[model samples]
Target: MIGSLFSRRRPPPMTLPDPAIVVPGITATYLRDDYPLPPEVIWRVLPFQKHFGSACLHPDDLRYEAREPALIRPGPLYEVAYKELIDELRYDLSPSPEAEVPVYPFAYDWRKPLDMIEADLDAFIDEVIERTVLTRHYYKDGYDCRRTVTLIGHSMGGLIIAGFLQATGGLRTRRRRTCPDHRVSKVISLASPFRGSFEAVVKMTTGTADLGLGASSSREREAARLTPALYHLLPSFDEGLEVPAPLPRTLFDPQVWQPSILRSIETFVARTSPITRTVRKRTEALFAGLLDQARTHRERLDAFRLDQAGLGPRDWLAVVGCGADTRTRLTIAALEDGPSFVLTSDDRRNTWPNGTDTGDGTVPFLGAEPSFLDRANLVCVTPDDYGYWELEDKALTRFGGGFHGILPNMNMLHRLIVRFVTGAPDPHQKTWGRPAPGVRPDAWDPPIPGLRNKAL
Candidate 1:
C-alpha cells in the first residue's frame, strides 16, 4: 500500500498518423523533369564544404575548389531522397536557375587551412551568381513565385552563409537584363558552429589540435611533408573531417561526438602552455576579424529591427537541438532578463562559454538568433520527447534525434517546414515544444492522437 501510493508512472507515448501526401495547389509550366524547374517547386540545391587544408597544394584550378557534395562520394542519392520527400509533401518550389551554388573550393581532404577557406569566398560568390543565372530560365512563371529564398546550411555550409552575408553589400555579379528574384527569407543552419564553431576556433588557433587546425603530428609528419602554405589553409587536421560520404539517416551520423571531443581538445590545449599560448597568439587577429564581420551583420540586422524596417512578426525562426535532461537556465534566464543582462555561471565571474550561453552544449542563446526578430519567432526543441516518431499521419509525422543535427532529418522537422511554408498549422496539432514568446496564431495546446489532457 505504501509503495503504491509513492509510485511514479511514466507518461504514455503519443501516437501519430500517416503523413498526408497532398497535391500541390499550383502546376508546373516547364516539362516537369526538363531544364528550368521553377523556384517554388524545387526542393533543395545544397552546396557542401570540401577539405580546407589541401586547397593550395592540389594541381586543380582554383575556380573548381568548391565541389558538389553529391558529386564526391556515396553518390547524389541523398538529393534524390530529399527530392522524393519534397514531391510527396507537394511543395511547389523548384531549384531556381538563379539559385546560388558555390562550392568550398578547398581540398577534398578535411584538414584544409583557414586562409585557403577565407580566400575562396569571393570565388564562391561568383559561382552563386553564375549558377543562379544559368538556372533562371527554370522558373515556371506565374506561380506566385516568392521573391525571398531560404538557406538551409550544415557544418561548413553554416560558415558559407556567414561569409556570404558578410559580402552582401559589396559583392556584386554581372548584372543581367532581369535579375531573378534573389531574396533570402530564412537561413536554416544545422549543427552549425554559427558563432565560429568552437572546433574551428580551437583548430585554427592552436597549430597542434589536428589537421583541421593545420597541426603536424608524427603520423602526418611521417607521410608527405605538406607545405606550410598548404598546412594553414586546409581543415584536414580536425577529427570532424573524418566523416565519410554516403550519408546515414536519423540522428547524428555517429561521427559527430559532442562535448567529449571538444572537452578533450580543450583539456589538451589547456594543459600544454606552449600550445595554448601559441594558438591564442596565432588566432587572435583572424578570429577578431571574423567576429567583427559577424558583429557587423548582427548590427545591421539589429538596426533593421530598431526602425521596424524589412521585418515583421514571426518572420524569422532559429531552431536548436538539446540533449535530454539538459537545463536551459541560461537560455530561459536570457529570455526572461533580456539581452542587456550579462549571464554568468556559478563563480559570478565565469560566464557561460561563448557561442552557447543559452544553448545546450553547442549553440548560444544570443548567437542562436540576432536581436532583430521578435523573441516569439525563435523556438528550441529537444530530441528526447520529439525524436523522429510519428504523431500525425505517418507520412507527415517524423522524429528527430536528440543530437545537434536535428535540422536535416525530414521526419521530425518536416512539419515545421510545412507550417512555415504553407503558413498553416499541422492539422493534427502535434506539439514539438513551446514556441518563443509573441508568435502568431496565438499559443495553443498542441494535442496528440489517442491521448487526452496530455499533449505532445
Candidate 2:
C-alpha cells in the first residue's frame, strides 16, 4: 500500500477493436440431424462428409417443421477453412485484459435459399449488437454500441452479406434504416462471386468442381443437385459463355442444363421416393424451382448499385485474388446426348485486365465483378502475397495460386481488417496488392490534417 504514494505517468486508456462477425462459405458450415435421438452429425463426420448425400435438402424435408425435435441444423465451422482466422481475431483484437472484443463466427444452414438466409442474418446482427452493448468496455469507453459492427464474408458468405444488406435496406435504402443499415459499420468481401461462378454449373451438371479443397463422389453429385445454394452460385455475368453461340447465356433455364442433371434427379427420386407419381414429374418440378429461385436472387443483386446504397470506399471493401489460371469462359454445346459444358483448360491464359492470370482460380475476374465495383476499386491479392513472417502458411500451401479456400488465413489481410475496424493505423503505412479507391472514413483519433490516405 505504501508503494502507491508516488504517482506514475498516466497509463494510456485500453484500446479495443470494433466487434466483427464472420460469415463462412457454403460447405464451410457443418450440418447435423437434430431430429434423431442422439443427433447425427451429417455433413462432417470425421472422414465421412458426404455433403448433401446423407442429408438431402429436398423441399419435402423443409415442409416437415412440425416434427418433434427439429430438422437439420448448422454446427461448428470447419477448422480447415476458418479456425486460424477466428483464433487470430480473438487473440489479437483483444488489446487489454479488460477488453472483451466479440468476434462471432456465424453458422447457418447453407441449404436454405439466399433470402431465407438473409432473414436469419438480420436476427443474428441484432443479437451481436445486443451482446456488444452488454460488454463492460463498451460502456466504460463510451463507444457507439448499436451501429459499430464490421462484417467479413468469404466465398458464398459474401453473397449472403450483400443479400442481407439489400433485404434490410442497408446498402440500397435511403429512407428507413433497418437492422443491418445502422448496425453494420462496414462490409469486407473476400473472393465473393457477386456475378456468380462457372464452377457452380460444373457442380450441378457433373457433381464435381475444382474448388481447390474438398473431395467429390457420385453421392456428393446427387447431393449437389439437391443443394439450393450451389444453384444460386450459377454464373450470371455476360460473356461467361465464350463458345456455344445460339445457346442463351441464361443458366436458370432447364433447357440449357446438361441432360445428366435430369437423369441424376430421376435416379435420386426413384431410390428415395415411394414411386407415387412418375419420377419425371417430380424431377422436372425440383429442377425448375432451383433454377427459378436462383434467377430471382441474381436479378435482385445485379440491379443493386453500391454508390446509391450509402456505402463508400471505406464502408465496402472488395478483396479479390489473382495470378491464377481460372475459368472465365465456358463452352456449353449441344452434344450427341444433350447440352453439356466444356470448362476452360488449366493451360489456357485468360484476358482479365488485372494481371496475367484470371481470378482466385475459383472466381474469375468477371465473376468477382458485381456491376458496382470498378476495376480500380477491387483489392486484389495473390498467392505470393503471404508475408515473410507467415512461412508456415506458405510451406503448408500445396497449390499457391488457387487460394480460393484459404484467403482469410492470409496475415496481410488480417492487419488490414484490424486497421479498418479499429480506426487505428498500422505502425507501418503500406498498401497491399492493389490500392482500393477512396479514402477511409475513420482515419485518426482526433482527425489528422494531411491524413488523406491513411484509411484505405
Top TM-score prediction, candidate number:
2
lDDT of each: 0.31, 0.68
Cα lDDT tens digits, model 2, 1-33, are 211221122323435556889999887778888
lDDT of 1 by residue, 1-456 (tens): 422221222222311111121111000001111122331111111222223222212212222222222121111222311343344333323223242222221111222232343345434444443343233232222111222334444434444444444435222343222323233444444433333322222232232321131333432221111222222222211222222233221111212223233333333334432444554333333323333433443334334441232323343334544332221222111132221112224211112222123343333333344344344444555444445352222332221112332334445455564455445544575535443322333542222111112112
Worst 10 residues of 1 by lDDT: 23-32
lDDT of model number 2: 0.68
TM-score of every prediction relative to native? 0.43, 0.82
